[model samples]
Target: MVIGIAVIVLVLLGLTFCVIPVVAHRFGEAAERAAETEAIAQGARGGVLAEHRVRFKESAAEMAIPFGIAAVLFALAACDAAGVGAARVLTWIVAAVLLVIGGFVTSGQLRAAQWTAAAFRRSSDPVVRGLDTEAIVSAAAREFPAWLRPLQVVRFLLTTVGLLVVIVALITPSAAAHFR
Candidate 1:
């Protein structure tokens, strides 16, 4: 039962932290690029450029659902309501892996957003210049809640702790039994 629950949680974490964001970011990038292309083609200004910015913002907002789900799962795990039992070590290992992957994904997204914003800033086009690049970039990069931002450091700490726990659980049979 514990293994089954851990598997389910792993699948959910993978989808929530990995698959969903990649898809959303790609689609959002496509939409933003398409809108920019159209605007440039039409020599348009203001409305379409604004929509392009909105697309970036929307893509960032798209993460809210996954974040919410993750938060709920986190709360459940914290409360020890996530089927903690014989598979505790497995659970911790899976969580550490997921956290590492999630960190990469999140940093990649932020870097992409910042790169895109930099490109816009460097553009000679009047339409691009008219839009507030700072606001757009902030919207894209500020996907996490303000309070949650500080916890970014905690992610690394937790990953280290999780890894240590897994190591201890592996090397010591008694510790492994305790984890179970």
Candidate 2:
């Protein structure tokens, strides 16, 4: 039963931190490109400022890279450690919160990608707002804050503690001589 639970959680942890972010990055890049293409085709001329839309998508993709690795390592250590119990639960909780934040922020990149794609599609469509694509996107892009910055620092600390927990869990052994 323990192994089963461990495997399932590990799989989810892998998907959440690994697959989602990577997949999202690829989509994000594509979306950014599509948005730019739409902007250009819409008779929007060239400039570095207009290209900023593409850069945001790339930044979002870059953000996902770390969280992906963190997820796998975090889960691997988590599964091997004998579940959250006793004082260790606090450690796990902190790690979990950090992981959640990391995952959410990383996923936001993917969200941004989707948003760009939809924006392009909307701008091109006759029924939609059809506002100047570059103008709107560039304006919005300037205002978007990097959502992952806070998560990056907090999760780094959390991951360090989690690693220590894994080490302690590994070395301490589950068969306590005290109980015997």
Candidate 3:
């Protein structure tokens, strides 16, 4: 039962700390790349665009640490769930990895707003210069990734439901016993 509780907690932690950041980062990268490509195709080429792309890539890589930690936790949880070989040592190793590389990534495509604003500020193009910097940044953030919309909904639902389950299992005597 203790193992059951541990698994639940691990899953919760993994989802909260690891999976969400990586997934969100990935979604953001795709959007940035698409935006970059579209801009290029539209004959928009300049130092600003170049810098924006560079920042976009850097931001994407920053989330790797959390993703790695989440992966390890999830794997340990799976091993625990399976009732297989013990992962006592493995858990420590994963923890170390998480500690070493647990750096955070950008929150979402919203980070792209900064890059976009920077690009606009640096651009020589009069049209780009004329655009409101704040508006562009705000618009960039507002343009939510269409593909991630459904996934976002699902993630929210699962997180809420999982939290409820964890709460109930921890509080109710009978339910708590099951996870003992």
Q: How many residue pairs collide in each prediction? A: 0, 0, 3
* lDDT per residue as tens, model 2, 1-180: 333333344434444454334443545455445545555566554432243333444356475665665564555545344543432444345446545665565444435545554554544445333435445454444443344334434344334443344334433434132112
Question: What is residue 72's positional error in candidate 3, in angstroms?
Answer: 4.1
What's the TM-score of each model vs. the native?
0.40, 0.41, 0.41
- lDDT of all predictions, in order shown? 0.48, 0.45, 0.51
In candidate 3, stretches whose alpha carbon ends up further than 4 angstroms from where it belongs are: 13-47, 52-72, 82-85, 106-137, 145-180
* Candidate 2 deviant stretches above 4 angstroms: 1-7, 24-30, 47-68, 71-91, 103-180
Evaluate model 1: give its lDDT.
Answer: 0.48
Index of the highest-lDDT prediction: 3
Candidate 3 similarity to native, TM-score: 0.41
Q: Write the per-residue lDDT of candidate 3 for residues 47-138, one digit (tens) a residue.
A: 44555443332255677765665777788778756644445345445544443333212223334455566666676786554545444443
**In candidate 1, what residue range of length 10 has the lowest lDDT sum?**
147-156
What digit string (tens of lDDT, one per residue) describes model 1 on residues 32-87? 55555554554546455564444542366677766664664454354333334534
Cα-lDDT of candidate 3? 0.51
Candidate 3 lDDT for residue 98: 41
**In model 2, what are the clashing residue pairs, if there are any?**
none
